[model samples]
Target: MNTRIAALAALFLAAPALAEAPAMTVMPSPGCGCCHAWADLARAEGYDVSIRETDVAALKDDLGITPGHRSCHTALVGGYVLEGHVPFDAVARLLAAQPAIAGLAVPGMPSGSPGMGDDPDARYDVIAFGGTAGAGEVFHEAGR
Candidate 1:
């Protein structure tokens, strides 16, 4: 009985520590204000942000990222493409929920988004992309 209890306690303790945070490689054009702002936001949210200054257009093409999924930059997060100016909270939710999708995107720059920082109340959809590189679903709708 003591051994059984010890085993259970070990499992419980190791479970959370084993769930490491996903690493994000952010590729963006140099001197892009909004993109920088977006990366900063993600960093503030405790993401392991890696900024790679590169040709934005080429980076998108190389990663199979298209205009419909485009934003100010591109990010590879947890073995998935995180395109555009996505909110950090949304990214956190995706990693936690572990949904059936290829990637997450916030197409185009919205006014009130973290990167843009204009429309604090602007509405936008956090879209999930499927494995086939197509649109998935509205993962989250934002007003904040």
Candidate 2:
């Protein structure tokens, strides 16, 4: 009975951490394997990812992912739009800080980016856009 009580206490202590993980819904272009790969990466990083195959172009437009900062997949998490293959760390930071920004984007797909095959040499910028239709501001640069 003491062991069982200890186990129950451990479970209760861990519940809050699990509950704090962000839930994300990703919309990827239909038949885009890379987008699927990206979504998988997000899941591995502990996000609750729900993927849907739809018209990504229309979705991007609707979400205000401007042409200059568009990618194959778009995700909604913590009330912010994440466009393209955004890095997991950036997402975590965004959620933790709850910045007043539109979202983060990787713009065009870079070879070394997550889900695009990690090519350590491939550098890319994660841009943060504010408001519903804000422009890109460099948030973080990877591989630098």
RMSD of each: 10.4, 11.0
Q: Which residue runs of candidate 1 sit more than 4 Å off their true CA positions?
A: 1-21, 118-120, 132-134
Taking the tens digit of each residue's C-alpha lDDT, what string does model 2 give over 17-85?
A: 344455677888888888889888888888777776667786676566679888888887766778888
Task: Give stretches of model 2 more than 4 Å off.
Answer: 1-20, 132-135
Candidate 1 TM-score over all chains jointly: 0.75
Index of the highest-TM-score prediction: 2
* Model 1 residue 90 lDDT score: 79
* Pairs of residues clashing in candidate 2: none
In model 1, the Cα lDDT at residue 66 comes to: 61
Query: What is the TM-score of each predicted model, taking all chains together?
Result: 0.75, 0.80
Record all residue pairs in model 1 with backbone atoms less than 3 Å apart, i.e. clashing.
111-119, 112-119
